[model samples]
Target: MADKNIADKNIKVTIMPLGIEVKATRGEKLINVAYGQGLDVNALCGGKGTCGKCRARVVKGGISEYTENEKKLLSEEEMQQGYVLLCQQEATGDLTIELDGLNNGQKEFVPDKGAYAENITGNDPIVTKTFHQLTFPTVNDQISDLNRIIGDVPGKVALDLRLLSRVPVILRDGEYRVTSAIFNDTIIALEAGNTTSQLYGIAFDIGTTSVAGYLVDLHSCKVLKTAFAANKQRVHGADVISRINYTIENPNGLSEMKELVINTLDEIISKLLAGSGIPPEHIYIITLVGNTVMSHLLLGVNPLGIAFSPFVPVFAESITAAVDFLGLKTLLPAARFILLPNIAGYVGSDTVGVMLATKIYELSGNWLAVDIGTNGEVVLAAENRLLTCSTAAGPAFEGASISQGMRAEPGAIYKVAINDDVDIAVVGDQEPRGICGSGLVDAVSELVRLGVVRKNGRINSPKDCPMELPEKVRNRIKTRGNGLNTFVLVEGKNEVAITQKDISELQLAKGAIRAGVEILLDEAGIAELDGILLAGAFGSHLRPESLKGIGMLPDIDVTRIRPVGNAAGSGAIMALQSKEQLQIACDLPKRTEHIELSLHKKFQRQFVRGMSF
Candidate 1:
């Protein structure tokens, strides 16, 4: 070793990754030095070395001090490779170090509302079946009707029994030419000659736990029909995290979930295609958006690494694949496939789809877009900077958990209003069968509004709150050793009850959303926001005033609050119509900045605080 005096001298260091170059006088702590250099090495445990995400690889000069905590978190191989805990190692001389991918990793999607309308069609791609005249068959050369049809179309064509049996009569009454109507590639109706009719297009929002599809005319984007159904992945796990965990735990769980979702999608595709009278192969294009997990599952990709430490997603850019590649038949073999761009591992393409549709990203004022579903993805941006994070908000609102909770399906309590006397107004204007997510929000909001629940989210009304032997609801509430109360949201005479386990689930969910927003704001150094835009079917129907009254929304200008419906689907549709939009989706990953919330203490503290009523 050289003279001790020289070793202890203040070391001038530069960290280039953050565009930060700062001097750390000798004896300064490593973490402080890193922070001073504008390098965000998250120390969730206040630099106690509890979390290991802040590992740094010393590229040049050695560190003077290395603590045991560094050794505990780093492998011998990594330690030998010059990796040091940024919180534990201090610079002794001129130094260059390799920071984690956080600084150089792919950027996230900034909220862009204007880009959402890029290339959406105004009409549906499906056409309703109708008839036209064809010349009656004559014996003059009496070519077979099948041969004539094969001759008209360039490609080899097959006939369904439904169409085959009608051919004789159709040819006998009409001429050689015919108008054919095909349902999902299966001929459903056949008449005479070329008839131009308005076509329809179907847009689908394939959520992880839920799937909603809309039927629209190809000529005009007017929505003609809509349908919703469960995601079918619940049988494997309720949330993405749990499902990922299950996949990690089981050998074939991931593949099973993937197959299940694809099958479900195929069935829906067939039903919708048939209902709209469009041949599956004839569908010119389909636009879809969902969370990373859902999209991964839909594409049959392994998602095991996304749930673990040093969290990373397999893909962040938008994807385009053949509908047939997904094992789902479509109307157009040549129809374009579009998937929305994802911001990060947690903030998915659905968020992009929503943001694209809302044009919130393009607004001049700073805006926040929160998609509150299985994952509470929050996007905040102003000027040129954008930040995003996702909270693991559970499935309580969607009626996945809770004793009496059900999905926002028929007979599910979707809305609720309570008076001082506790008289309730149920959705569908009928006796409440079970509460859906909206109803749950209404229940919690009403409870807070009526002083039945504390600001901290603790239930205050044990006697007045509907408890006791509904036998159905009571049996569902799960009990723990601590005696913390949970109520069932749904019960069935023959099915498992949605129990109180769901309430804790909801709290966790909402808390995560709150935490993600707080963490993003903290990272961006923003103390106040100009506006918050809720994007989704759920967000559109929610009462923002009540959401705020219950402390779910941040205090902001209420006038700024707005809803941009189905932004994700809209984004996908835009991509379907324009190559420019597709390029934007591809370029988005490079401009986004992802702030890891779990690495920061502020996120945890804020999450805990936001867990209240």
Candidate 2:
């Protein structure tokens, strides 16, 4: 309590280890203040204090007294150590806090679209430019400019009212030689000279955490350049529900969120053109796919409908719009945007893209395709019919909720094994910073195999060790005076360890995923038949065996567990290049039945069962 004057009462909160500082007001939540300053704290539940995602250790100065939320979320020892949920704690005065490594700004490694580029070949593009030598208007054959341009176009072509005004000058400038991009039976552009071969389409995967954009030449179906960036709308929240709450609560928040994503897309466009030397006008088409909320946000639609019970989406069908509507600059005046159709209230166009890329909808035998992110989508298909469900796994796997968790960056521990001795494989062979999702899976699996953790996911103390373990293993399992147990994976300057609370977090996450899969399988009326395709950024590095051991995935043949990298993006790429592939994406959502796992009777039972290792 330094001062009563507003001018003199600036609370400076310093977050250490990163050496970041932010200005705060007294009585303001630490999470809200940090989030308002664009700091990345784990507010996956939108500062509601239910997720227990954002915890800070107050190194100096005073913080508000802990509430029941903090008491239930944080350990008593942690409370004694000045650790409190940033969402639950408020600023009392200037404070300095030490923070654990939270964000994983790792460069994702998704394969090029050429992996299945051939599958979508031979189909005509929805938009194609053809060079035609139009007969110039003569006195005897005086036809309107629009008619003259469409005479040699083979079939009937509708011209935009805006393009009709400039048709005369464009044709004269080209000396009766002009190229027109045909969208179905409509002529959208009238460009002078032959530029038919320079067509490009952008395939975008709008993930909750990040966005992946691919600039592809539709003529060759070749991916020219790729761009990746964190999603700008994450400031509102980590998941769609949080974003929905943001939109419903704040005025003009919808427009702001929409602009944020659009700006990101524009930046990606700028980057793609800058890196590949592709002319802006040459990029004419855009195919965007994401969850229902992201798709709605891109179109400036309020997504609160999908955030509550009896979830309903504004639009699940495919949509086509003018590129300029998104406030983006393009080289071609005829550029258009195509949003891939969404599946359900929760299952969105990204899943449609995944199905198109993997051809899972057309495949026979029992097949399960899962796209993991903040929200996990699982599809169980058996050729004729498919059952799909969305699992709220939170952001734990992406390294948000855990204390020593991080993204798969250079210094991250990506692989771990505890045999006679503990072995760690870092991402870039650098010093261990923190464990990533894959590392967590491997560590948990190894611990189970070594009998260090029980089947019910209990970490046994050294005195209660069931088997004689290596001294290194025994030393790592420590019980603090507060009676809380934790296992240290790496003991160094930046110590990396997993607490008992972390295990519970992981159990909740993996349990949700496992239960969702079981429900879909039960609905599909299949036990063990065919394969499981893990599709997304996290799946590429995940070990199927580890996923099985931790009960995140079913115990299936490792060979059947195929990691189809960025299938959603690849499907968008396919849709970008071929009208037939685009149709496949459009027709998918109607046939699949979306299940609500929370409303299911056996969900709680399965969730509890799956929580055990």
Candidate 3:
């Protein structure tokens, strides 16, 4: 009884910027408390104190002392400014906490458009509306209302009882004239007369780092509006394995993760509707494509199996469920939610989407398509074969796991070049706060080209730098308090730099991706001579020259490397627009061969070789 009371005892915690107050247990962690009240605290390491991303300021309360990880990760000035790691600190009393832009729901930058062959071969959408004017039934010639509506419809029509209940009212309301929304021979909705022109649908690409939504007018097969937001599941971790482990370790982790992503989709759907002045009921279907883990999480399926050896997902087949079952706020209840199929434990539907959008299966020549993100998925089409593998590239590219890394937002450095001196391009033209993924790639690419970083991923000291190297560039190399060498990008009161550990993280990421590419090439027993397609928001932003300079990509002419913007999202849009495309998406998993890099014999040696510049 005493233990129960102690566990139930609560204290107040005030979150700033929103000024929201919530009650927490007496000794609870502030990150947990904030997240419990629906606040998005940036804990990329799943509150394990490894990522050092959940840093918050304590404005009005005394908290627990820092741990060893905190001492190593936080700067001296940050500690002096009343900042503490939220995951490591316990709330000893009432507290007021302030979150930074990364945690305060700041808008993230995602590529709004992609380069896919916009030739939608067919306009036959999955859901279709047909206007019907039925003859009124009398005592002399009477027929059942359900039979009368579905008599002319082809195939075995599955009837929803709830929709059936409204049939009489709709038939009478329109005076025997009505429109029926049909999906896969299922009568999902019944509306008033001549409402076929209001048909619409939404397609979503649910990436581990971000979610992109496209609202399409099914009538004209045109995309009306698009929306993007950072994935809410990022608070748990930046990779799928971390998120899966989170679900295993916590009691309510699965449900919580599902709710977070659903919330992200809801926000995006609201934006799409508001921006286009479309009614929620007008949307008849929603199509989604994501990695296997993301697909599992969205459907409330436990992804524990996919996180371990002999990884096996509960289901890799396409799934179709109602929108209401998934807890979407602004979408209509009867709308069909379709999730495309997955190929393997790691090689998921997003890869399939990439193939669908780029039509890699039908390409005559050998081609390679790589979707760059925290979890990089690579596809190679050569010798009449399609091969794919997923690489654990980590969060280095998305600006996680680096000491001074952040998302591509305002004040983030997104581009860099080193000639006489280092020059950087910051997002929003603001001061350089930290380096993002593209900036990290650009900086390291320039360093490798200039001999500042060696082939073995070592940073040359100022004295050891080549005699021809410019002095201004050499002077930027310095050692920080952690005793690791760092290359300074912006020198100031709050200096932005990339440390030795950051380089190592990037090496591991790029090495994994390159290794995957090599393994696929070797498996096909072919030498690469064709073009490469970079597919994703991250891939769209990266420079092809920089990618090759860093040894992340193969040695190919810059013109051969092309950026297909958000091809996975484009695949989803294609599926939403045409039933033929959706069927192709469903059948892609069966056709393409998946190469499990973990079980491959040459992964370790190839990884080591690929790590070098």
Candidate 4:
């Protein structure tokens, strides 16, 4: 009776940008309204109001008073500035929201697109062209121009209405000699002369922090050009949960985030086309590899379901759809986007790509694969007994959470070494703007060595720090501004410092990851793994020694640790080039297992244990 009464009170709300006018229950929270409308809101806490990411500006209607959670998460200035927490605000009446973009910073990871060094087994391009000369049709031999062209081709092929429009002139202009570009079983394009040589595909890895893409020549299976850019969605929120909450909180949030990613891909795609001197029409296929949440967001599917208890995804199998379906069809109208399959809720397709790139599934002995990021995924396998889990590592590793942290771009410090004195290496050898993930690891490792920080992540008081240092180094330590004992890494205008909370963030990140690794190893009944296969752009930049110092990695032979740069992207590349490779990706989920960390009887104990060094 109560459910029926609530259903009777449904109201309609209008959303702009996406221009959605949908029926929502009266007084329903904005996140649920947005979620029901298929909008991706930045609700990291699943509308619990713990994360404070799902915020929207109420432009048309008045909202209820702010809650205590809002006061804690948002600044008073921001609240007075008109920003309202979406989770706390209810749809009392019709409302309009203005979704803001995150200011652009950091470049995307673009792998070098040179000659194709990896061996490709087969040439089975979905789009290929065939050239044929037809006999001139007189009245006696007259057949329709469509049939005439179809007869000249080797096998049965249908002519698309779009391409059919060009058939008349194409035959006459080429004097019955023409090249027909066959996409799948249909002729998509007709050329006056032999233009069958141009064939390409693009493989992409969409990460939480960045997106990387590679353009490959289908004929030769060689990388022709590559392009990347920072994911424009970062401005909305830094992590997947944040982006999810945004959709839940804002009416048009989902569509807005989807557009941002597509635009980012379009930008990178344009550059690749320009650099390769290939027409967009020539690229026949694209394979996108990302976590399940990211894949859901790209498909404009609501991921809030996966954000809460009993986490589940809308699609677990591989998806192949025409480019037109994604709104960027103009760039590669003939292309079909292939999304690799996900292993489970949090362990996504990117992990499948990791498996393929590292060949860990087929490998013997104990093997541990960790792709550390905002959400860290760890896979452990002994022979065929595979186990995997995703730990909420937070955004510390990506130069997030820390006050002065930034992406590994120009002017960002990438490395550090300390003995008698401190030494640093900056990306592009420019002035130090901020420290990135690699440098953070380096600093933490060196600080531990120099006794500036204890195993509990407590910054030493000047007296607690046993290592005697120069006056300059000693002067860098101070405490102020909601601060704990802080170590100033840089001075001047671009002042950078690491505080007690900064170390705490790192501790949480590393602990979650390490605990996940331990759980997997314990399940497999192995004391230690044979080696560590680190994937992801961040993993590539991390030093084994630094990771070990932070207790993020297991104590293993230093020589055993290997960085497989963008293995997910490589897996996408392999999928684009070979059907067998794509099949291997699809088959991975069946053989693998996903372990729920929170549900584990020992998770709490391990988590508490992991919080320390």
| Predicted structure with the largest lDDT when compared to the true one | 3
- Model 3 lDDT per residue over 1-613, tens place: 9987875577788888778888887788888787776665567677888888788888888888889988987878988888888888988888898886456633345434344445554579899888888888899858888888887567678766668778888889988788889998888988878898898999999988779888889988888888887788877887888899989989999998999899989989988989577889888899999999999999889999999989899999999989989999887788899999999999888888899999988888889999998889999999789899999998898777987788777777999989999999998898787888999999999999998898988888887778889999999999767676789999988789988888999999999999999999999988774899999878988999999999998888999999988888888888888989999999888888988899999999999999998
lDDT of each: 0.61, 0.80, 0.86, 0.77
TM-score of each: 0.62, 0.87, 0.94, 0.79
Error of 3 at 108 (Å): 7.2
Q: Rank order by lDDT, top first?
A: 3, 2, 4, 1
When superposed on Cα atoms, how far off is each prediction in RMSD? Answer: 20.0, 4.4, 2.8, 8.2
Q: So what's the TM-score on candidate 4?
A: 0.79
- Candidate 2 deviant stretches above 4 angstroms: 1-122, 329-334
- Model 2 vs. true fold: TM: 0.87
Per-residue lDDT of model 2, residues 1-613, tens digit only = 4356874657888877656788887888877776665566656566778667577788999878788888888888988999888888888888987763443222232222223233445357667889988787788988987777777888777887767778879989999899988776788777899988777789899888778888887787778888887677866667787888889988998998999898778878888889576778677788899989999999999888898888889998988977777767544545788999988888999898888888887788988998766688998887588889999987778776776776566677889878777899997798887787789888988787777788888888887775568887988998876697788998877778887777887888888988999998888777885999999888766888888888788889888998888888888888888888888788888888989997999999999988888
Off by over 4 Å in 1: 1-201, 215-224, 249-252, 330-334, 427-430, 461-505
lDDT of 1 at 400: 51
lDDT of 4 by residue, 372-407 (tens): 888899988886888899999987776656655766
lDDT of 1 by residue, 472-583 (tens): 3223344444576543333345232223444466677777888888788777777888888887767766677667765667888667777666677666665444456655
